[model samples]
Target chain A: MPQTGRSGCPINLTLEQLGDRWSLIVIRDVMFGNRRSYGELLAQSEEGIASNILADRLKRLTASGLLTRRPDPKHRQKGIYSLTEAAIQLVPLLAHMGAWGRRHTRSSKELSVRAELLEKGGAPLWNAFMDELRHLHLGAPRPARSVFGELQAAYEKALARRARYAQD
Target chain B: MPQTGRSGCPINLTLEQLGDRWSLIVIRDVMFGNRRSYGELLAQSEEGIASNILADRLKRLTASGLLTRRPDPKHRQKGIYSLTEAAIQLVPLLAHMGAWGRRHTRSSKELSVRAELLEKGGAPLWNAFMDELRHLHLGAPRPARSVFGELQAAYEKALARRARYAQD
Candidate 1:
């Protein structure tokens, strides 16, 4: 179909698109921290992806429909990047990767907490989490019963706490 | 710990080592097929990984203890690469990645068959598959019973079929 991959295997094709080192880190920032601006993503990434590489990956990911870049209503020079439905669906993959890492590698206590929460919540939680984002920004259908209500509340609380610290 | 990774998150550390485009592909070739030599690996990889990049990745993987390379007993010019226990443990991750690909992307029919086999076999099957390699090359302990009897049997049958075809 598309001429973007070396093999016809879907997994290989997807890996060809998303398997690079920087792309997932960018996606991780978008999915976890609500960090979409270039500066926010670049700052949060521990890997120190080059600015050129970051720009290239952002362009490619957007072209692939995994991310969307829209004009920031609040800022003129900045663009807000958001995950698309296809990208949001990757939460399971990301969660599994994180879980595997937690099991096999040395991880931080705070990181493990997030991984455990995601694991305990399972696919339904991820689905509802995505639905919440859609409801907030994309006007998509809402979850049947606000399944992630408490988790989202907790997340918001944490964000507010961080914002308060930033003020100081 | 060694100063190689960006974060204490185990996944990040593992990704630091294995997150590149070529590392997993190299591991996959060693695990699934009988590819061991530099020439064989290069031949099997359709994506045309740069020779320098391939050399670098192989060295890094070996340094990380995921693979071991030695002189080919029968061929002095070639080196025989074998998977270590760490690499074998990656079967689950690889299987999951393949399954994810099969579920989401367009893939090759032949490759999908292999992925389905891995999926149906589950983790124990993956363990047994690794044990088979260990027994064959590494002198590692064998399973109490024929844990991967079916898979081993299938491999033999396929080998025989290939021999017959080659003779014809």
Candidate 2:
């Protein structure tokens, strides 16, 4: 990312850093999927991001300070990537974006469950989730509340409800 | 703008719809710059967006139902673009984005004033701003409060302060 944006406009700068479709997807995987390795990010991606594009985005994200890459102790050839504080702070932005999409777009129930939970849970939930993320990605002490477990349980419950409704 | 996203994830859907750099910029201009006509949107753009990119984004945004383009009454050859209810509802999203960018990025004081105000003012202020936007763009009954005026004044004051600091 460029040190200077097209203009000093905050929105423009944010867009410049993370406005593309792939960058946030990478962040989302790190945050939600816990896919820290390049292979995992590549193979587990539902969006089917191209290998070259994924490689480019990882480099860009690392350079932009949203991600940090470190050598994996287990394998000299492999590197493990982790979210930096900057990327962890994107929870609210991602939550709001997810909320907007759920309300406005042709969203799937299973896919949108997280967004619904985030919207209903609001800032308190978001803060807890971010705290949990810091622990997961940054080695911080885990919070007493597991917002991730709460969110995942909610999502799984919604999925079960949808499965029942589908049978009916 | 495809009907289906790469995945059904709400965040991915939103990214697919608006993940590009220029789409939101076009929206920002129409919403804040009050540049209703194509010419105004083109000429007054701070980012100097290319004409082709602008044309493409306008078409994409209109296709996505974020904007409505109608023949200008004053100029038979010109079209005036207005925000739909969907776009107006984006005030909160934009405000949060601006706030995130202001804190995380190297934003300028003059440019970030609006974001600062939105952060300080929160949802009540966003609702008022959206109401004012609805009045301006959708021809709704104008709200008595001038949130736009208030925001613009804050931006101007920030600009003046920057100018003074520059002189110093």
- Per-candidate TM equals 0.73, 0.95
Instruction: Give, for candidate 2 chain B, the lowest lDDT window spanning 10 residues.
Output: B1-10
How much DockQ does model 2 earn? 0.83
Clashing pairs in 1: A9-B107, A10-B106, A10-B107
Candidates' C-alpha lDDT: 0.71, 0.88
Q: How close is candidate 1 to the true structure, as a TM-score?
A: 0.73
Q: Write one digit per residue (lDDT tens) for candidate 2, span B1-168.
A: 454578989889888999988899899888877888889988988888999999988888888999999998888899889999989988878888899899889988888899999989988998999999999999999999998898889888888888898899
How much is B28 displaced in model 1, in angstroms? 1.1
Off by over 4 Å in 2: A1-4, A164-168, B1-4
Q: How does chain B score by TM in each prediction?
A: 0.80, 0.94
Two-chain DockQ for each candidate model: 0.41, 0.83
Which ten contiguous residues of candidate 2 chain A have the minimum total lDDT?
A1-10
Q: Residue A85's C-alpha lDDT in candidate 2?
A: 90
Measured over all alpha carbons after superposition, the RMSD of each candidate to the real structure, in angstroms, is: 5.8, 1.7
Candidate 2: TM-score, chain B only: 0.94
Q: Model 1's CAPRI class?
A: acceptable
Which window of 10 residues has the lowest lDDT sum in candidate 1 chain A?
Answer: A146-155
